[model samples]
Target: MTDIKDLPKKSGPSGGWGSMKGIKRIHAESHADPAAFDTLRRQNKPGGFMCSSCAFPKPANYKPFEFCENGAKATLWEQTRDRCTPEFWEHHTVESLKDWTDHELESTGRLTAPMRYDAATDRYVEVTWDEAFQGIAATLNRLPADDVVFYSSGHAGLEASYLYALLARLHGTNNLPQSSNMCHETTSVGLKKVIGSPVGTVIWDDIDATDCYFFFGQNPGTNSPRFLHWLKELKDRGGKIVTFNPVREQGLISFVNPQSPVDMATGRETVISDQYHQVRAGGDVAAILGMCKAVIEVDDEAARTGGELVIDHDFIAEHTTGFDTFIDFARRTHWSDIEHHSGLAEADLRAAAAVYMEHDRVIGVYGMGLTQHAHGALNIAMLVNFLCLRGNIGKTGAGVCPIRGHSNVQGQRTVGIAEKAGLVPMDKLRELFGFEPPQEDGTHIVDAVEGLIDGRIKGFVSLGGNLARAVPDQKRMEAAWARQELTVMISTKLNRSHLFPGRDAYILPCLSRAEIDEQATGNQVITVEDSFSHIHGSTGKRTPASPKLKSELEIVARIGKASLPPNPKVRWDDWIGDYGLVRDLIEATYPDDFRDFNERMFEPGGFWRGVPARDRIWKTESGKAEITTPPQLTSLGYGEKDGRYRLITMRSNDQFNTTIYGYSDRFRGIEGTRDVLLMNQMDMAELNLIKGDKVAMVSDYDDGEDRRLGGLSVIPFDLPRGTVGSYYPECNVLIAISHHDELSKTPASKSVPVRIERDGLAQS
Candidate 1:
């Protein structure tokens, strides 16, 4: 008999009983353990570690219950009472455990000690920490420097990622890639080209100041629920919340403040979106062009009629350049093309523009929806253009917020975890750490995966990430590991990647962000930067789950010492023992940015790593804001939309990236299972598909390989016609690695062309 998932018939407001159930699920998952409760309390308290969930920065003033629903799940996932001991591995071989789901693997529990692969036994047996480190070093030292790829995860805090990148550079390769490559690389690359900084221009307070805003390609309700509170507050304060996406997310439609017991009990949900437009996948650039054209036309008409012009002429003329060129290009971009591609009417575009032009301050925000496409960078640049038209950037309630995926993903890049070799100057690195950092650009996730597949890269070192599952082409990437000489993971728990061991594999168990990390110096306090560039310190105060587990800092330092030739002059030991020295060195390298990094850590609310773009200090090559031409229709096309449908992969409310916390998406009304596809009702009707119709999606690309996902049932959704949605990692298999944004190299995970056919045997 087939597994019938508990599909909730009715979808309601995001944050009422549904959120309560999520909170309950978290508590129940932890088995109502007092330690989990205590751990959360301590983690949320002042002077405690920041939540390692999504990168929504914590408020400066601490709250006893600052964590969100997913935050609780994240902590519970890390601090679970379950333990994976050596004896546990003896019972389940890696070959046997290979079929287990990603959730099952992580749920196996935190590793109690280091483990090494046993070829004959096909199991990972316990090994000494020294052996793990030495073995990692030996493997890397033996391989060609470029053959080793170092990947970083968002869950990895700022300090750990920094040290991880440094160790990789010390090992003499720039083959460093991280979560940024998969999510916000477009934001960084695009913004840096114009604004001179690859970061969001707005701080948290800007949310309150803006009177009107649009979230293009973002649904904070599921990805960032805590952000929904802010969105609710914006609406409560008479601010307009406009949304543009292929699927009209329920969270954007309305929300009930989970923290407000009165609203939660009364079943009162506040309306969130003033305007919602269902733009198709890869249609964002066209939509943005339409908006700009509308604003320009309005200004032109107002000028001719002797009415007040709506454009922020002063801000545009003084703070930015190339506006006239942008206007010319936007005018040249035809309304019909935009309408055809975006599935939006000119009237709707003008109405949204009316809202934008009426407001003096507007904050524009976006996520992976904009960044994971062929013209992703252009999509981001065009967004900056929208804000620039109204003088929004660097204003009180006006700026760009590139909503990042991981808590410290932005923070890692801040402290020096870059794939580009010279990101941290070799002169500066040698002056501080006494080593010549390589000068060639390194492999990002896509390049790393390609290298691994082609046998060019034989060793892979990941700092707490499920790379095999997270990347596109799941089967190919997973099998590519077999060709590797060695694979090492410095992580707290076992994941899908661990099960796919290479010839030589090691699991170096490290402490999570929730546990107390006592170094030789004392209890170490690590710093993490938020999406908005606020740097804060997080000190995990709970007792370690296993005394055998070492801090991420310790693991990196040990590996560095063993891997690199002895250089007593470089205080790797001191930096490892005391993070303050590391911060001091960071300040030494980035004197202006981290002037008083150590002292700032003690600030009541974290200090800001100010963006020059927000301050009107242009850092671009032109010394002013630069604008790009509106994307050509070719860059925004999805072949012929006859029988093929545009697919957009998203995260379920119960999931975070590849980490599947649960099977249900409470927000989307899908429950108890992930083996379902969310297709537009019209599309489903056209295909004669019904709910629970077993089908397999076939990729439209002629990639020689038959890329397909079989036995997925179709479920109707409120999405644009010819567009469909499914949770990522599950759908990641359909996206070809070659299908990526040319500029940022980010996988076009959000938009993939596919066609679905009913599975006869499965239906039978």
Candidate 2:
């Protein structure tokens, strides 16, 4: 009929005719009404709902057009009219739905009402909210609190997440693992240890003032396109941009400003990166070591010439400790090792380091690429080390920015959504909530999965996420999920997780950020803190997708009251009636930052929660910034071996975390299917595999079952030799639950050692 959707080419710049075409195509979908789309336009204006896309700071000043392509897609996606009503569930079995792809499942539309699994029918039958809550409460009350894992996602606002965490603690369990456990936990774990603070220390204004911008492992064009405007401005101001990643992402290469009508009309684009180094997957530690080494040599050479030394000696002596040890370690690290591991030549590394040396105000940017690894925490430490060496912290246009993967993910942690104690502190909780929280740390996602597998965990309550699909080792996770006695998903739409039912399961449909939350008090606007620590309130302009749907805050409060009856100390009813009381609690808890939370949020674009690290304030045990030597290079992954390639899992351009917008990944020039593995052209040729050949890949892990991925199309791509790439959730099969950062327990989804063999074909 039509040409196959497999068209692989060098991806062109973003935000031109292609973006317009994409917008037109998306809007043309039968379910997205034009009038509703126009209605959403006004919502993005002043005093309107915040875009639930990326957590990039909303501009302090307003523009007529505020959201980007993906943001619009997210809006339309939530506001889709393709109803998955009770009748739809009546006709389709869960087994039949399982055959459908993630795209088909979500596109089925916003969940209309609560659904409970029927064992005999093998389907989710629509049920009343009271019936669903009663069933959940009965099962939950029957189980031990320690066996319950209360999880949150990026979708929930601060009020919901805070209430989620508080409910868990009140129930006498600290097992509150959210999306951060899967995405940016490493940044939280590492940055707190290094820079004396967990959150990023830079504001949105820093992007414009930065002289040299280093994007370590992020692709902002697809993840956070608004950031491209800042990059374009930086380039226009004669600033240099360098990127170090395993793949030469199109976003990092060039971008056309959608805001600039002239550029879009003329098809003119701005080149983003001046230098890009294709580091081998899992080689971030080595790459950082190499950069550190080059900077050391450059500084020495500058000193020998009787010129200004590149190293900030005064800053190192006064602001940082362990500089001498780091200096010695970097100097001793061999160039051969760096070159071998990073796949970057000595000259390229030197040139990158020279760029850093050339600028006084440099910002280091990184993403999940650096965090979803075995040495993720170490990788974060190295980036901080690099920035601190240049007197980056507590200065204008200079700091480490760990670009997070989801909106409001950082805020969840700020509102005390941690597994460990001392973060929010038991004393603080006691004083704020008038009750004592659990003293010890609880389970991470990995540990929670293991608990389920080993028959330790009995219940799981999800605030808003597809845990079964987002988790590593889907097979194992699904199996573990099946064993739970009770499972609950408080979500806006149906996803893969709802299908993997436990003995008793309930789906509590909740309101999306795009839908108005009308409570007993009044219409409520929830607050979320951005990646840059910008806090703002979002007021949904549209009516509820379904009249039966409850806001996440309401869903959480109901569950809390049902499962654990209101204690005299904590008035659950009060917080549920008025969200302002929730803000009051938050302000009372973290008074220093959230003192004027309500007043400031109602202001233009909210307020910036200041960074302690930016003021030369250290909260470390030693009260000084510390830069220890990075872990050995052997820690990256299984080293090079014949026919053994490193596999890194990534999200397609059209996807957001676990939500599939479409089957096509237009940015990477692929469509229709996601069953392809991107391999280096030379690696494919060496393995005697063609572009469309099917292959079976086995992980290097010694498990007898052989963590294997079968029937995958091999697509030749532009990547470093000995490295291959595949989409996550599919390739998540290869990642062992145990394979994670030791400190953070974040699944090492970015790097895996694997071997591929031709399937039912002879060598060409």
Candidate 3:
């Protein structure tokens, strides 16, 4: 048997897809000059496209060439020389395309024309733009507005999202399911309940001013490398960072900023977190409760001795309610239980609490790692409770930051893409659009899939996103898509979702951010909101990949005009023809911060929407930040038997959410493949599993009968016991649709129970 220690070491450049096996894949293709690429990445330029990779906020001051490795790859991938015209589709059948790997299908390059599925040949055939739009309009007009679902991706611009929201509302449907429904929906739900806002309160500058940084379930190195700049500054000034995650991500340990030439030349990597703890999977809620318990215990001791150990007793006494209830729960929580569940000693937790008590200002940042659990919403609520106990919500350098994945995902929600029950925004939409939008409370991404399988939904119109691949249960999702009567996709490049064609399907080619868009008006500038809530103007610098392609705004506008009855009151076509006019309408429709969208976006460094929390103004019902009670300690519902493990899905360092940049995870020492699973040495030994052993993981849920995803190679590492990790999208099949947060409807992608056996072996 091969020992894990003898496994080959993965080698590659320090950052981005430089470590990917397909490093030369783009270089092999014929591309334009580097100067043109540099010109597109410039700040204050009209065409500075938001990085399609992650939702890292663009720096206030722009660099000459600020594109990251993954961002450059996404740009080149969208603006490649390769073309998939009618002839290419003629050669490949839908069945054949189905067999092709995701990387192979995408690498085939950009689609140059609109295409419709040809049932006769089982392949897509080229269609005219007018014919495609007319067919879509006909189907949309036939269906009840509630039956039609409009899904948006984070890759879209603010202008495009605004147009999409308007079109959906104008058409009388509030069924706008976005990428946020799958990722940060829990953050939005939990934060709103606690602080009256869904977005994070921290800014880039806040990181530097904070005395302590607490990161939960986030790996900044791979997920958001741009954060390293702020962490480095914090470390330089003697500030400390604390990290809590199930896996010891390399990014949390050390990061060598690729943007810093001197650091890169010197090969010096800055240590990020001063202390790191690997909490057990699905243990974030417990870990946070443990910390709060320690704080309360210290306060009790201080009160008995006539000394002050608690940080913000006055803030808690005056501002919060239900404190006695929260304290009762905290005092009842046992140290042994906390230690066992969190996989950390009580001493470590107390040490962390000490740092929080000593520091006057602290910031807590998190990502999907916390929100992908069954108790994800509860985890976020507990984090909020901890912060409010210290009056950290509305203070400089102290707040909660939920790092969003898509570039404009947070912005999409901010501009009214939610299905929140009885939300005031939906009522506002009715006042603006005349028609009372469906108030039945529409479906989220998971519910949408269930609706698709249950035959409640018939039509799907996606603005931008690989929806089929992005959601869990890929096989089931693909089958459901096949059942749809009409499925329309507006995409910039070919992806897995395009291949999941309906009986009547259309793939409309669209313009990318890097491409110059010449609309009916001479030229256009689009707006985008970053993770930090900064709205900025972006223009296209390069030529459009094809004359056949149209901007997302144009396609949605045309569809709205074609589907809706002629209403002279709302000039849909005019707005579609001119994007700035759409921005003006948005400014008027939602007049809180964007009074003059066009003028504010023109200024350098863009403009910030008002964040009342940043100024210590709590928008909660009581006009004070609320303290939440800790979650009840119940059995995690995992019947831990011999040889059972909890498998958590994760993104590779080189990859973004679902888009596979390349099949290598550099930090984990994985290469040339994403087919391996990370396991703890103790678990592997107890299960009698050796390194390189082929294993099959079956879901523990009875409803997940078809959820037996297998053929994974086992790789033992320093992960926590009873926990395993694998790449997402591939492992998404193992997660059952029913396994989701009840409040937010987000899939529990981080906490899936499974029993692994040797390949082709039956359960013991």
**Could you tell me every candidate's TM-score relative to the true structure?**
0.96, 0.96, 0.94
**lDDT of candidate 3 over 230-306, digit per residue (tens):** 78778889888888887777666766666667776776667777777778887777788888998888889998999
Q: How close is candidate 2 to the true structure, as a TM-score?
A: 0.96
**Candidate 2 Cα lDDT to native:** 0.82
Error of 3 at 607 (Å): 1.7
lDDT of 2 by residue, 36-81 (tens): 5765575444467877778877777766777777777777777887
The local lDDT score (0 to 100) that residue 715 gets in candidate 2 is 86
Off by over 4 Å in 2: 1-9, 39-46, 760-764
- lDDT for 77 (candidate 1): 76
Model 2 scores worst on lDDT over the 10 consecutive residues at: 1-10
Residue 522 shift from truth in candidate 2, angstroms:
1.6
Q: All models: lDDT?
A: 0.81, 0.82, 0.76
- Model 1, residue 333: what's the lDDT? 80
| TM-score of model number 3 | 0.94
